[model samples]
Target chain A: MINNQFLVFVKKEFAHVLRDRKTLLVLFGLPVMQILIFGFALTNEVKNASIVVLDQAKDHQSQRLIGRIGASRYFDIEGAVDDEEAIEQNLRSGKVKMALVIPSGFSYDLAHRNKAGLRIIADASDPNTANTLSNYLSSIIMDEQAELNANVPVPYTIIPEMRMLYNPQLKGVHNFVPGVMALVLMLVCVMMTAISIVREKETGTMEILLVSPFKPLLVILSKAVPYLLLSLVNVGTILLLSVFVLDLPVNGSILLLLAESTMFIITCLSIGLFISVKAQSQQTAMLISLMGMMLPTILFSGFMFPIENMPKPLQAITNIVPSRWYYIIVKSIMIKGLGFQAIWKETAILAGMAVFLTLVSLKNFKIRLE
Target chain B: METVIKTHELTKRYGDFIAANAISLEVYKGEIFGFLGANGAGKTTAMRMLCGLSTPSSGSAEIAGYDIYRQTEQVKKNIGYMSQKFSLYEDLTVMENIRFFGGIYGLGSKDIRLKGQALIKQLGLESEEKKLVGSLPLGWKQKLAFSVAILHSPKIVFLDEPTGGVDPLTRRQFWDLIYEAADRGITIFVTTHYMDEAEYCGRLSIMVDGNVKALDTPSALKEQYHATSMDDVFYELARGAKRSE
Candidate 1:
């Protein structure tokens, strides 16, 4: 026989969520907004970065090299600094990202000895930008050298052929799609469920629900059902956008991906349920979920940072974060095209978390209406 | 005169604070029993225990032929609770709220629809039945809340200050609903701070600082204390009460 009370409770919860405009906005708006922003505004590709040049020689070759570097779209010659202190000041003041120091070398060096040296000082506070800046500058100088030696033959030249696997374009969107999915799922499933349950407590409806014929576990299950469905819909929206708009393909079994997503969503919902049980007010529930879950999910989940590069203690802590395993599972399945065999460990971890959280929340759910 | 509710020294304590001290009382079926108390007088604590919402620290009680401690599920199924805070989902429409409460009580769809329609007509909310409950006036919401609480025809309905924060006219109309439910043999166990509403109960029990200071019919309580009204009787009993909270 069907549970009449469960159906009623679920319907009420659905109505509450659907009718709330703010919740509806967050449920649908946040995922799409995050994807679009990550895709367009937050790309790593540097363009027209301002740099200062200090040419001590001021010779034809030095001027030529500076002109060549400035001609490229990646570098813009902000000014010609005459002194090293001026270049340092410009870099320190954030007026320029890099400073090119052309040494006082005679043109006879490059023309006769076939080698000349230049120095590039970059602000390494933002390591990624510094690295990118150095790489771009080296490529430009090397391009000029290749042109000069076009007619000459090198006896032993080792050309390294590099190929980027999976994401050949190296689009930042591909890097962020899986991470965004994990963050958004955790937000919708964990944070929203927590606030919703605590809201009932704040409004005194939790007491009424406990007093009903429905068991507390069943009540929790009913609250989670709609969010589960909604999170699945969020998954669909993210996937459709990632595939069609962002061009990130799902190479592994689509069914396996969805199954893992469902498991992760359950884990997050259980976490939210546990938070609701511990918190007495909606504000407290929200604070706990956001601080305890969202921050950890974003930081330790390997969403933005590589978990391996982190310190040993931090890496061990990430082992318990559900988002870390979920990110690994989705990335392997979606980007690496790895099947269940390759991701069984992560899947098992997520499932274990789900079961543990469910048990804890069930134990915390008191039937006493207080 | 069957006893629908019977309690013996029902106590609830948190740490050293006694929210509901060792108190005992009873009420017959179909009797409108007024559980009167000042703020934090343990009337709500006692009612919460009876409605199976809270467990007693010690002693025992039987509600509608079921033990409050062991047969909590049965007790829940037999009784209806209307908290003073207005326990209906404000986001839901009037009809949806009615149907939800009705369905939880295991009523069939046809019964929910029929009873829901009848309630809508009786409350003169035919036009507003589809309207969201939050948009309605407070008085109308109170009446609808009470109706929903008794929709399942439980053996006893616990209303904790159901008429709180409403005007006098609305409260009068709300009392009519309580009297109607009591006339249909549903035991009305109500708690209120309004002394005038206490007079409407068939028998009144005034609690002072976790103890039932006086228990008798309204007229008998007044006569016993040589007071003019329930207001005076309440004042005389609560004058010397020592708060434990």
Candidate 2:
């Protein structure tokens, strides 16, 4: 059985957390917001993007090219403006996400079998969408060229029986729901735990807790329990939102989801504890957590981009990011409907990360307060 | 009185700087010992060592008869500490704070509830048991901190400038609590800058720049310096500190 001090310590932690609303917001509210933002806002699927056209060639070839480009739903010609000046003005003003200028092309040249060139400009400000839209435009052009090459009344049509697997129908929200849950939970759990401990230090509450007839680990543990529960609640909220609000799929068992989430919660709490040890004030703790944990989690945890496509150094660093494994676990279990048998490896990795971080932090704590 | 705490040539150094150098002293059971120092005088360092938060550099101290280095867990069980900051959870209700600290000391839930209720009554905080500690006045928090520090009736209590930031009337009330605990056979080794509070100590030690300049009763210290009050004595000693440099 755990020592009675540990129980009381956890109880005190619960009491402390309940009395602080900002802590609740950090642990629960922030996670929910992150889930919503990641799920809804950070989608990869291309949508109605504003575009402009400078059709220098008013010929059939130019019209056909514009028709071919605008025919796809990805680009909507927001304006039909004159000359390169208008195109540049519209593009620079951010009125159009993409712009097409068929530069003085004559249908007579295409009829003479010469190359017909079309200039495509897109708002590459959002690099991901710009790249995706560029790819989609290129593929559409390639498909039309191939159709012309095959030249039959019923040319060969390509039908892809594509299944998006975990995120069928390829909804960006599917990917985001899991990513946001992981990212938010990590930020909330780690940031809150670190800042809470730092607050005690800044306010001189830590010395009282330390000098009491309680073990130091008990004090740290007490600080952890409140956030642990809060993170779980956030997980539940994200799950509900994914199901009810976003209509996202949760094909896996939720108990399994909760189990992995608990591991992540503990993992993040240890991260916060470790951060607190390095910081002397709440402000320092907050900055450290924000810069150290939050940024890295978002960038490397496959939240916005595929980790496999990233550079080799990032791949190496991803091994150290606990949220990377957590995102994998959430995606696998929630989206892929993987059972414990399939996800046990990821779960073990998370457990190992949590145990390792918690132990290392506790060791530092033991040595420092010695 | 038997020795409740003993240190043999205990030294604590921060890098090359000697914070507490070969400091050796003993506190008999129930003695109200005062440790005096200016800011950064190593008084806090020495206190931290005695309370098991810092390890002495090369020597040894025994807390509640347990070796400071080897038996810290046992030492922790028998001692209570209160810093100038009072160290109580301000956001929690008075009773919840009591139960929380009590629980961490391994007290059963029922015992914590029963004793917490009694403690609230004793502190004349019965009406505000449900009130958050943060909302309470500074003086009340100081008293509550001291009471909670020794709620488990530890053999020794260490007060690190426990009366700081409180009014004169409340400082006196806090001393009454310290004296009462000392009278009950609890060793009271305290650190403070407030000279008037030092006079209340049965035996006092003045440290300057990590060295103990004087270790004696307040009366003896006043007599030695030919000063009228503990404040005058401390000022003379502290001013003497500048001249020695």
Candidate 3:
């Protein structure tokens, strides 16, 4: 009996969703746009940064150092500056992100004194770029010095060997793909489900449905089923884009990733149901879903901002946002190649939230019209 | 006549304000019971209680031999309801709305298909079955809503101002449909502010300030109040109402 009724109800819901073109676009287009934007355009890696050099020595070593810095893809040599004042002008005008100063007698000091002095200055206005450019330049100089000392043995030269595990190239796509998955799923499931349910109330169809013999829980469940399916489709789209377009592969089990995503979707649907029960109109539901759910999913999920950088009180609040847990789970399974044993706590928390929200919303769902 | 709906002093209250007072009434089988009132006269509140959409704060009521409080599912099964607002899904096609409503009422697929065809044919919407409900005129939508309400052969259909915003010719046609359902032995409990529509009911109840001020046939009400028309009778009862919308 339930099978027939549920099928018919779900079919009606699908018709509602498909007939509206605007909702369809948001459901499918948002994740694709977000993935492409984050993958290629909004990246943390700095490349081809412009820099000015003050080469006072004009010797073989100083010329070689400037050649090495320009040769690297990290910096673009924007002509040489003869004086410290010129370097200061380039830095202040933002014409150069960094400036290099090579002292005189550089090759003689390096060969006889076994030491050379080179000062690197960077514009600290954009701190991240400044820090990254300075580090890149220092690394290039270190490599040149190591090559110079290839034949002569040094007493105590300690070089730290660094290995970037999981993401060897330190690609931004690897980080944002999981974050986007969490964000897109949360927005689509929560906002769409809430609006759909509250829309019935606004249109007066909910009154008719409530008056029918159909159980109220069945009605609410049927509303959520379509969005759940759509959210899963969204997840599939995001994952495919990440793999094919972004070139970010799932390092762990695909089945596990899908399973965890389904859990998160269910949690979001329950939240949507809760909002629908509390909200009286579509506008209220949309506002609550976007402001109440989307903002926290973006801010507290540790995607755009680091949770640790926030105040201690806010860090404690981040624990309650379900996306925070889902973000960690996705990163663990997708990036770290971990299994269920690794993400069991997060999965358990999500499951607990799903069950708890479903119960609360169901309990609060009024069978009788007020 | 067999009693289909019986209420003993049914009352609903919200804190100190009473939305529906101790109003006792009964609706016999196959009778057109007109619930008449002003805007805030509590006509809707009483109908909501009888339809099992709202629980009464005091008194008792029964719908089709089922206790309203305990057997609400059974009560819902035997009744169909249309609210003051347009109740059909605007995005859904005519045939789709019929099938969905029929499906939720536990009708088999074959039954739904047959009933949907008959309903569409009877409403003269054969060419417009594929069009969305919102695209139809207000009169057509109202007629379709009425037809769908009784699709499952429910014992009673409750209409809360089903024809509020429509042309007079359309309202006459709507009343014709109501009369036909009444002839098929389906009890229609309708609420309306139109005095002309009130005169067409077999019996009418006028409410004022949450209390049933008068209950009888329209002719008897007119005679008892010595009024010329149902409008004069309604004004005589409702002019004393303390609440105004």
Top-scoring candidate (lDDT): 3
Clashes of each: 0, 0, 0
Off by over 4 Å in 2: A1-3, A34-160, A163-174, A339-345, B242-245
Worst 10 residues of 2 chain B by lDDT: B236-245
Model 1 per-residue lDDT at A211: 77
Clashing pairs in 2: none
What CAPRI grade goes to candidate 3?
Answer: medium
TM-score of 1: 0.80
Say which prediction, candidate 1 or candidate 2, comes out ahead on DockQ.
2
Candidate 2 on B1-245: residue-level lDDT in tens? 68988988888987898888788888889999999988877888899999887778888888888988787779888999888675888878898888877877777788888888878888899889999898999899999989998888899999898888888999999899888898888999999878888888899899887788889999998899999999988888787554232
Worst 10 residues of 3 chain A by lDDT: A155-164
TM-score of 3: 0.82
Alpha-carbon RMSD, candidate 1? 9.5
Q: All candidates' lDDT scores? A: 0.85, 0.78, 0.88
Query: Candidate 2 vs candidate 3: which has greater TM-score?
Result: 3
Tell me how each candidate scores on DockQ against the true complex. Answer: 0.45, 0.46, 0.56
Higher-lDDT candidate of 2 and 3: 3
